[model samples]
Each structure stands twice: as structure tokens, then as C-alpha cells.
Target: MWLSNSSCEEVVVSAWGSGSEIGVEGDILRKVEKRVKELGQWEKDVFGNVKSELSRLRKEIAKEERIAMGDKNTRYFHSCATKRFRKNSMEGIRDEGGVWRTSQEDIGEVMVNYYKSLYTSTDRRVSTGILDFVSTLIDEEMNESLCREFEASEVASALQQMAPLEEPSPDGMPPLFYQHFWSTVNNDVTSPILSWLNSEGLNGLIKKAELQGEIHGYSLCRRGPKLTHLLFADDSFIFCKATMEECDNVLEILKKYEEASGQKMNRSKTSLFFSKAIPEEVKHEIKAALGVPEILHYEKYLGLPSLLGRGKKESFDYIKEKVWRKLQGWEAKLLSQVGREVLIKAVIQAIPTYTMRCFKLLASLCNEIEALIKRFWWGQRGDRRKVHWVKWEEMTKSKTIGGMGFQDLAMFNDSLLAKQAWRLLNNKTSLFYKVFKARFFPNSSLLEAADSRMGSYAWKSILRGRDIIQRGAIWRVGSGEKINIWQQLWLPRKHPTIPLICPLESFENHTVDSLIDPSTRTWNEQLVDGLFVEEDAMLIKKIPFSRNVAEDTLYWPYSTSGNYTCKFGYRFFKEEEELQLNAQTPPICHKHVWKEVWQMQAPPKIKKIFFGEHARMYFQQNMH
Candidate 1:
């Protein structure tokens, strides 16, 4: 039933189609062959010409789009889509379709038409391969011709006229000039010299002979008795001081290298500066034979400006500032990678290690981070008000106290110098200490001497802090008294209290007889098993006494306690009952000192001590 209904309801529509047969008729179709010949001639003449026009049209369209959208906002989607559609359509045209039959004559005409259209098509691939090759060949030939023309022209003469006058030479002597000097030497001359030296065991000898300081980069070679310095990359300076005849032998080696590498030394810049310190007979012989100058200096000289000059100071400052800026930039980049919380914490932690440079770098990092965060997260807020504060404490706190532990670079610098005292004392033979001593205090002990010339307010301040520790606590161990080993090693000679120690160097060295007798072992073991009295009590009791101890007796809190037995050892005090009974004394402070002493004996488990309400509040505000 459905099939019958569909068949009876057919509708028909007709319209004129643009087919060759319909449009031309049979008579016109015969004329089409003659027209095709004319069209082929027109296409061949116009194909390459129209390509430029097509490109111009595309550029104009693109310019209009750019003006409308702004260059940054312009989208590639439309251009890409148009290109893809054109490619698909052209591909379809290439394959046989309903309008075109693939006969031999028909295929030939179709291909010819396709080729003609391709030269001017919007698709660039059509022209790229062949055009690129032809363009490259043309450019090469043009370049060659241009180079020849330039060589024959007056350009070199004109350039010389424009150049500044040559720098004045002493005695009106014309300075020697070398052309393509560094390039020729670097490629042709230096490589073989390096290779020859690397083959011999005397490479170091070659490097020593060059001795051109830091400015004049040079290469060298040494083979057997021969040594050559490749000066300014092209010229060779050859000499051997091993024997009188070796000097001539060195020249022969230089000649061989020059021949092999196709480079000749400029004899004009090849004068030698001979040492005047050599024996008079040797110097006379060398000068007479070689005609070398006796300049009293054998080493290459650097042309650094005198430090007394303003220009030299400015130059030094500029270099230092540039280095600081570069370091700050690196720090800024690193801070950007870190989260705000971590960066803030690090800054706070670093404050304790204060130095002026570190402070400046941290401040710069903070400012940079603040600016970037404001730009990104609070754009409108930043625009309205230029200043932003993540927290007031970050800006207000002294670098030493806990707030935002950013280092006080000035203090940190002093601390670093102070630390050097330890190395000076402990490693007197170290090359660095030896050099420092030679430069600043040649006649003084590195351990005891502070350079009066170099000492500043900052250095003095660090020394003052160090002096405090040197004069401070004395430990009582059993019946003997001693001080920390570091105190003896590095404490300034002028320190108020000199450290004293028992004959035993360390606690481990003390025998059972030295502590309590072996007879008391059972009682000591029972005491140790019952309670954890730290071994620090025994160690502290052994420390030597100081006159300052008597003067500061009131300040010595633990000294009030009389002798009392604990798990680790016996603690002897002046009045033991006073310590047991004094509840008003700060338990937290006592616990801190107790733990410090305990760790000296053996590592102790730390117990957190709670502070009073007032103390806690004070610490919280100050810490932040």
C-alpha cells in the first residue's frame, strides 16, 4: 500500500542548465576548439603575472581584517577554512567528474588548464618548491656579483675616511695593523697549536708562556723543548728559557707551526719584555743576542685604572651594582615559583642570618613579588591605590627578631667575617687564611689579630656579641671546672675569662676513677636507673672557675642549688634546697638551660614548657 502511493505522486521540475551542449549548440561546439586554442595562449601569458596580483589581493584582505580586529586579536580560523575548502574543491576537479570525461585529448586539456590555474592559485604549495629553488640560485649569483662590485668600489676608502683618528703612539711610531687577524688565527692557527699541546705532556708550559692576564685571550703549544704563544690568534710568540740554544730552537718550531697552519707572525708586535731580576750575565747575553727589552717585568700586565681615580671607583661600583641586580633578578624569579606562604616563611627564617646584601636582595624580592601578585590578583585594587600590605608585621619588624625572618644583610656580613676567626685559628696553614694574613695583617696572629684598618662599626658590633659568649658561663664538672672547647680554640686573646679544662680532653676520656670511684658504681647505676638526671650535670661540674663567676653570682640561677644526685650524675650547687623551693623562678627558663646542659651530656628529649599568660601574649605579638 505505501509503495503504490509513493509511485503515483511523482512531481517533475525543469530548468535550463549551463552545459556546453545546451549553451553552445552543435555549430558553436565546433567553434569551441578554435576558442580553446586562443584561451590556452592567453593563460600561458597571464599565469605567472596574475600570481603577484593574487598575492596582493590576499594581503589587502588580511590588512583589512587586521585593522578591524587589531593584530593580536586577529583569528586564523577563517583563512584556514577557506584554504582547506579550496584544496578539497581543486582535488575534486582533478578526479573525473560527471561534466568531464577522461579521454586522452580531454585529460591533456584538463591538465594544461589545471597547470595554468595553479601558478596564480591562492594555495602557496603550487609555486613554493620550484620558485624557491630558482630564487635561491638567482640570489647566489646576485650576491657574488655584488661582492665583486663592492671590492672594486671606493667603500673601503670611504669607511677609512669616516673612522676616528688612530690612537696616538709614543715617539710617532705608526702602529702595526693586521687584517682578518683574530678570525684567521682562531680557525687556521689556534686549532693545530691546541692539538699539538694536547698531544704533549707540556700543555701547562704552553699556558704559562702565554701569561696574557685575563684580557688578551690566546692559545699555546709546547712539544719537547719547543713552546709557542699564539698571540691575538694570528701571531706566534715563541721562546724557550731552558738553554741558550733552545731560544733558536723555539723559533724553528714556530716556523714549522706557521707553515703547517698557513699563519705568519707579525714581527712588529713581537718584542719581548725581559726580566731585569735575571743574573746580569744571563740578561746581558739574552739582550745582546735577541735584542729584547729589559723591562724589569716578565709577567703580562693588566691595564686596570688606578683606584685613586673617580673613574675607577665608578667602574667598580657599576660592576658591583650590575652583579647585585642580576642576583636580585634570579631571586625574584625563584620567589615567583614559590607559594606566598613559603616565601614569607623563608624570608622570616633568613632574617637571623642578617647581612646588608641579603637584606637588600630580600627586600627587592619582596617588592617584586608584591607587585606581580597585585597585578594578577588585585588589578583594580592595585590601580586605585599604589601601595599594598599583606601584613603590617612584614614591613615593621627588626630583622633580628622573628618577624618575617628576612636577613639583616649588614649583620649577616659581620657574622660571616666573625665565623672566619674559627678557620683562622683552626686551619692556620690553609691557603686562604695565609693569603688573608699576608694581605691584611702579615705580622699578627690570625686568631688574635683584628685588622684595625679594616674594622668598622659593623665588625665591632659582631665582635662585641662574640665577646659576650667568651666571658659568659663556666661549667663545673665533679670537683674540676672547664669551658667549651670552641671557647679555648677561637675566643679572642683579650677575652675577660680564659677557658680552662681538665687534663681529659672530653667526657669519654674521664675514667671511673675520675668521675666517682669504681666503689660507687652500684649506687651510681641505681641513681641513673631511677631517674634521668642528664650527664651534663657531671660535665658542667668539671668546668674551670672564672673570676667573673664570683662577680655575677646573683645571675647564676642554678648555682643556688647544693649537691643533689640525679639519674645521670650528681649536681653540686651552693644551695640545692633553694632551687627545689623557688617556685617564683621562671620554670620555662630553667627548663631551657636544663635542656641545653642535658644535650651536652647526651642528646635529650625536649619537653615543651608552657609560658604564663602575660609572657605568652608578649611573645606572640613580638614574634609576629
Candidate 2:
């Protein structure tokens, strides 16, 4: 039978018999038969004895299946259905251990395709400028070489005698000899050589290049026999990839560009990083270019240590420590000169919007300053008493608070660090964490345990302050009872029949169960009762005809008789005269026994709490 029912008994039997009829192999069919028999026995022996258990298990399985299907649908909707749903579900998936995977090869293919399309779409003529320039230079060089070859035999005798002329000056030389030599040599030289001599001219072409706007600045220079490659700021990667002769040829071209540009090369910024041993002639040329006593194996420039040895980590540490020490010294000097205020401001400027630690440090430093001020100037101050009582909020507030507004570094640092939470949530793939892995914590971890170096005293102090704040005092206003909609202010139609007040000592201890349970009482029941007494009983001096209670005895409805009424004073009375008489003499108004009236005028203590000197001052200050 092809059972359509989804029940376990029916599905299992159908799957087993269907397997038997499919002409499956003997072993497979036997295994299926054995499993079916076992399942049938289990149904008869285990399930039949526990009737409700089977039904409950079925219900549970169905519920779980429904949930699984719903979750699968949610994932599919996010990935293929809508962009908004995809964004919303991404966080949920990540939290649920789901990871999106893409192949590096696929990424590379996409990048290559995009570049190829871009190149193909471009105009050929516009893209041929570089090739054309290189070709023209090569043609000129070839022409010069051919000309030199043609004139070599004729010029041999003249060049032979000219070599021994010693100290031949351009101005002092005989006119005929000078003209013949200059014309032969200048005309025979390759264009690359001519360009190099004209532009670089041996002095350095960095200045020329800068003047021509070809380079922002000269980065490096390495000399070669008859030429030098002066690296401009525009060139990120420049290295000799050919033999010594080819290198020299390339250097000649580079020199020509440099000489024409008028920018001087910075030999200090340059170095030769060869995979194989360099030629002696090339080394000599490089020495001449750099003017150093000798070429060192390694050197550092712009705070980056050159990678020449295996001690890369050590080298980095050496440079980093030196820089950090120097910064610290500078900070100390700045602190001394400008005082803590300007020093803190400078630190803040350096860190700006990057970390909350900066602000916390500022706040901590302020606390330190306050402590110091109190120790040194408290007793000696004119307004000593007043200064001690000054609230931190008031002290940090603007002049309107009767004190100068100064930054509280502790609070500032906590708030700043708190921003990191937002940053991490937003930028999951920033390189800052990658570069300084130890400085930042991994996701889903607390900041306190992160392996951040306490590089600065201010930063350490800020962290300490943050720890204290995490453990500091917390006050809550509400009964442990969960309020319904009527009790909430936003739900205007929903007002609590009676307001429930509870003080939460520990935030973590508060829960929905504790809030919903009305019977749960707090240690400070009197305080809660004072704030939320039934409206009807608020003005009642006593319950009439009750011998067990005195005239001024107070009773909450639940604590009193079971038949007692619960109402507020305002809702209880319909007339002002009745309210006044009831307040003056309760128990005389029997007709309005269900109601109690409170005088519109509040009691002395209530007046003190609401309209006393402090309250009046607060009201007047905020009146505008």
C-alpha cells in the first residue's frame, strides 16, 4: 500500500514494502525487512504500552519539522528573494553558525574579466602613448649606433691621438681639434646616452623631474656605469630585471627623464635588492651615486627597517620601540609645558574618533586632577566646604552650573571605547585589527580581557575607570511586577489599576517571571507602598467599626479583609464638600463608605518632597 499519511508507522511500512517490490538486491532487501520488523515490534511493544507518549512524540516531531522548514525558507528568501531580507537575515545566519563561502579562483576570474573588458573597450590610439615613446627612443638609439659603426674606421686615427691629449679643456683646446672631436663623439652617441648626459648631466636629475611635474619627489637613485636609475615618487616598483649591460641601458633612459625633469634623486631612500650577486662595476656605479663611504648590507629609511636579515621581528621591534620612546618623551615635554589640559587635548587630537579608550583616559586623568587638587588646595581654598560638596556633573557642566566645564576623562574614555562596539558591528573586515592583532579583541569577546598593551598611563587609568563603572551603582524605578499595556505611558488607553513600584538592586537578577508575579514582595515594601497606595484609601484615617484597627491605622487591601474595596481618593469622591468633610472627619460619611477623599492641599511631608526649597529652585531654573 502506498500510504499517503505522514505518521511514522504508516511511512515506515510503506518505505519498507516499497523497497521490497523495487527488485533490490537480497542483502539490501533483507536489511530493509529486518529494520521494518524491528520498527514494527518497537511500535507494538514500546509505543502501544505508552499511548500518550506516541502522540506527544508525533506532535513534537511535527513541530520541529515545521520550525526547520521555516528556517530553511527564511534562508532561501534572504539569499535569493529580496535584498532587504538578505541584509536582515545575514546577522541571524552568522549567529547561527552559517558562513558564506566564495572561491579565490572565482574572485580572480571576475577581476581578470573586468580588466579585460575595460581594456577592450578603450580606444587603441589613446592607449598607445607609452609604447610610441619607447619605440621612438629605441629607433634613435639604433640610428646612432649605425652612424657610429659607419664612421668607426675613419675616426680611429683621430680618436687614438686624442686619448693621450691629457687635460684637454673645451675653452683652451685648438678649434679644429675640439670641433672634430665634439662632432664625432656627440653624433655617434646613442639617443639614450645623449638624453642622459643632457638631462641628468651627472649632477642629479631629481630637481629637473620635480620642476617638470613628472615626480612628486625623488625617492631613490642607484648609479650604474655611464648611467643611473633615479626613481621618482610616481614609481612604486622599480628594479633591475636584466643583465648588467641591460640595467645600464635602462638607467640611461631613467637618467634622461630625471635630467629633463630637474628633480634630484634621494640616494638615501634607494637600495639594490638583488636575488643574485651584483656585478663589481654596478656596485662601483651605485657607490658613486649614493656618496656613502660603503654600501651597507641593510639600512632603514622613513621609519621602515630594510629587510636584509632573518631578524625581521627584532628589527621591527627596535624601530617601533625607538619611535614609541621618542613619542613618549615628546608627550612628557608637551605635558610639562602646556599642563595636563593641553596635553590631554593633544592626545585626543591624535586618537580622534578612533577609540573610546581615548575619552576614558581623559576622564580618568580628570579624576586624577581632582584628587590632586583636593589634596593640595582643598583646605587652603577660600570656598573649601562648597568645593567638597560640588557634584561631578555640576563641576563638568558649563558656567551655567556655577563651575567651569572641564572634560571628565573616565566617562569620555568609556563612551569612546563603547563606540568601538559599533565600529566592529559595522566594519567586520577592517585591516586595523589584522595589522595589530594583539591590540584588539576578537568578536564576541569582552574588551577587558583583550590583549591590548597599556602603552600610555592615561589609557591604563581609563581602563581602570571603565571596570569600576561596570560594577558601579545602578538604580531602577519599578516593581518587580511586569506591567501591562494600560500601565505604560505610551499606551494612553492602558493605565495600571494600581501602580507597582520596585527597586532593582541587581539588573541581572531582574526577569520577566519576577516582574509578572504580583505576589513577590521586596525588602523595602514600605517605600513601594508609600509610592503606590490605592487611590481610595490614601486619605482614609481608619476603617470604621473595626475594633482590631486604630483610627490612624493604614491597611493595604490584600493585607486587610478579603471584602475590602481598592480605589483611589480622586475617583472615590464626586463632590468637593464631601471630600473636605471626609478628610476632616472620616467614618461620619457612611453613604460614601466605598470612597475616600484626599484634600487637594497636600500633607506637610508631601509638600516638602514636591514643593520644598530644592524643588522650587529646580522648577524655577527649568521654567524657561
Candidate 3:
């Protein structure tokens, strides 16, 4: 059913449009979709036999998409498309007397009245039975744990785990703000939350999950000194056991917090995720007590899925869709290859990396994403791939050796996850590391940790990139205390340095410090020279050390500054896999410079005028 090139153009080009004014952009997209749909099998079948015809259609789509991206209309369009707004006119509703109400005002009043009833108490009688049960729920043991005062370290631990991009509270402060100013405003921020947690409630406070927690099981993850509520500026989450007693206590605490903070609760967005194993009857009781829907898992935290099981495809399918939706904009087709490359690199691939870094993407998922990108890059529609002139692997190389410097998604994802591993390895004192330690690997270091049946997707993903991160980790010798001379990356070679993988007894306590001369805090040349051949000894000798203030540290060789970066990690993997360069360094040739001029965002007449003037000058100079 493939239509002729001419036919494809007629269908596509007619609906192409512009302008960010309300309704205009959507109209264009809607028209494009409708007209394209009308072509039906022909639409799928239609591709221009002539390269020019197809190219024009590709250009048209790109033109529309590029405009949308630049103008910030894409977000608006997406919101319009996804958000289901209530009809402005009234839908018929039955009044209390049984008469039908259809007026807009009547409908509005009815909706308001219905919502008001949810939070309102019709009968004001105090339930002695409920109160009596709540009082009995907490005994000497639970009260001792729950009543303890929260220390600054405990609050600091919570603040450290807050991701920067987490939604801003009603105070208009995002987690990023508190994170940056935590040092300066630590007391200001934590004081309110600490005060709230310490405040006595109507009944027993948090005893359990009741509230789940963060990575690096540190001061933050401790269920007790039992935390009842944690407030992020104006935003807060109440944590308590799934009992009527704890739920009632939380309600009183929240009421007090609202009075203090001046922020109302958004009940619509709030939900309860309980243990999946909880009985249905129990779940309903808890849900009723909290007045929030109960489910096994809820994913509204910081815009990331709070997954407890192994990372699955469905967990990341949203990520893929997010990536594709960004790519699917018609305005994208108008961009020059350079512009498209920038968009793909900066926008298309970027949307998912944050999530990808925190979790291992399925290989099939990775392939699907890569395929989607490849199609976009080549200006292909449906199955009609427009000559992918270069292999995709080559395209991922750095601009220095000369691929387009596109990040390979799989490698990039690994690199991002490796960063988390780096944090776990280097920053053990951080709450994240401590939490991860207690939950995932209490007995072993991050590298030594093994996967378990109950391990979370995040922990598993971090482990996946542990080896890659270790390979790039160059131990900067200081005290030489943390660096493992044999186990960790101590050598600066292209390959891993395994210094005689033998018995621990052979290496005198298996510490890097054992090899360091205590007096100079430098490598013990005698000990080093004796332990290895010429090549290994020389590498050990080149390992630098500072006696006074510099602590022994591990850093990446790929980065110039020794700091681990996502870009550097990506580049390292790309070079290792493909030694091929798709383009030459710098001016591979000025031959095609003029040919590229056509893609410039300028009028054709302007380009001609500039080139003509330059040519005349060149001719005059030559004649002279």
C-alpha cells in the first residue's frame, strides 16, 4: 500500500503548521494525525521513491518540531494532549430532593459540596472506643522508642538523601534548595521537622512501615528514635503503623503542622502503599483510617518509582515512552543534522538518564531506545529507514576522534549507575552508603555484595556498574588506608592491575598502607621492588603520595581533574568498544563547508550575497 513519493508529500505537507498560540499548534498536530490516518495502509505504504520528495517531507516534519522545541510550545502541547479537563458545561447531577441539576453553577456547587463532605465530620461525638484502642496500641517499649528526641544528625541524614529535582513544596522551595543551603540553614530547615516529630500526638506515633526509607541505611533510615512525620519545608509525609491508633495520631500531628506551616494538605495526590501481603480486610481498615487509597506500591515519590522488587521492563517502559514522546514532536524534523544532534544529545537521551542511572535498563529496552533514536537521526518514518549512512556504534564516539559525540544510551546508563556506585564506595560516612550497607550488604562492601531474591532494582543496578567504576578508579595514595593494594584499582594501567592475587597472609594484613613507607607516606620502594617484576614495580613507583593533609583517595583517570563524570565514563566505554572514528579531527576537509552552508538558519539570498562578495574579493586578490 506504499503510496508514491508525490502522494506522501500531498498528505503530509498540507497539514504542516506553526505558531505557539493556544489551539493553533494542537490544531496542526491534530490535522497531521488525522490526514496521515486517512491515508491508512497507504500512509504506512507511502514513501517517496525519489529521495527529494521524502527529504522534503522529512524537512517539513522537522520544521514543525524544531519550532515547537525552540518556542517552548512542546510542553504546552503535551500538557494539553495528556491532561483531561472537565467540560466547562454542566453534566446532569441529581440534587438532594431528586430533581436534576444541569446548570454549570449547580454542577460546580455539587462538586464542591461532594468534596467538602470527604474531609468533614458530620457528627462531632468523640469515640471513646477508638481512643481507648489507640491508647492500648502503644506500650512501654514502643513509647520509649517513639518519644526519643531527634538529633541534628538524624535530620541531616534525611536532608542528604533528598534528590535535588524533587517537587517544590507550597513554600516554593525544592529539595535542591534545602540541599544547597542545608549547611547555612540546617537549623532553620530541620528545626520544624524535628519539632513536629517530637510533638506529642493523640496516640502512639510511628512504630513501623507504616514508613519505608532511603538508601545508605544511616541515621535517616532508622525507624526509631521512632519518626512519626518528616516535613520538607511546607511539604510533609506522615509515617505510622497501619493501625487506627497510629493513623489517628498522624492526623492530629498533620493538623498542628498545617497551623504552624500554613500549607494545606493535597489529599488528591496523597496515597498509601502498604505491604502487598497484608490481608484485604486489614488494608481496607488502614485505608479508611488514613483516608488515602491503599495499594501494594505507590510511585509518586520524587517522580521516581519506589520499587522494592527486581528491576523489570514495565518499571522502565514509562522511561522509554518519555524518551519517544520527546522525539515524536514533528518540529524536530526541521532541524539541521547539527541541530538535531544537539537536540538528541541534550533533550532526547537526557530525559531518561536520571532514572536509568538509578536503575539498570533492560537490554531490550535499551535496544528499543537506540532504535528509536537511530530512526530519528536518519529521518526515517515507521519501517522506512532512510539510509543510516554510518553504523550507530561509530556515531557514539567522541568528537575529538570524530563521531558525532552522541552518547550510546546503554553505555551512558552504565556510566550514570557507576556514579552511584562511586558514591557508595567513596562516601561511606554519607547516609546513603550507610543505609545501602544495612539493607543490601551488611556483611560485605558494595563490590563484595551479592544479589538477593529480595534486592531492589536500584541496589542491583548499582552493583551492575560496580566493575566499570572500579576499573576507572585510580587510588590516589595519601594515608593509603582505604585503598586496597591488591583488590582495588591501585595501578594506572589501561588494564586492571592484579598484584599477585594470593593469600592475604602473603601481603601483611592486605592493606595498601602495608606497602607504603610509614616515615615518608610514600610507596616502600624496597617492599614494592621485591614484590613485583620491572613493569609492575615501575607502575607502583609512579603512584604519587602526599604526607601532610591529603587523605588517600580513589579517582577516575578518564577525567582530567580525577573527578568522576557521566560524560567521561561514557567516553571511556565508547573508546574501549570501537576504535573507529566516523569523522576526522577538526577540519577533516573544508571541501564540504559550502555544502553545509545551506543548512544554516539564514535566508538563501543572504548566504548567496555573502559568498558572492567573498568570491569577488578572492578574484581581485588573485588578479593583483
A best-first ranking of the candidates according to their TM-score comes to 3, 1, 2
* Model 1 lDDT tens row, 549-593: 121110111222211112101111111222445654344665565
Worst 10 residues of 3 by lDDT: 209-218
Candidate 2 or 3, higher TM-score?
3
Count clashing residue pairs per candidate. Answer: 36, 39, 20
- After TM-score superposition, the amount by which residue 438's alpha carbon in candidate 2 deviates from its true location, in angstroms, is 8.4
Q: What is the lDDT of candidate 1?
A: 0.36
Error of 3 at 613 (Å): 27
Question: For candidate 3, lDDT tens digit of each residue in 91-151?
Answer: 4786554544443444566778878887799998997777776656788999997777877
**Which segments of candidate 2 are over 4 A away from where they belong?**
1-393, 398-404, 436-624
Residue 496 lDDT, candidate 2, scale 0-100: 16
What is the lDDT ranking, best to worst?
3, 2, 1
Candidate 1 Cα outliers beyond 4 Å, as residue runs: 1-203, 206-402, 418-422, 454-624
Among all candidates shown, the one with the greatest TM-score: 3
lDDT of 3 at 126: 95
Per-prediction TM-score:
0.26, 0.22, 0.56
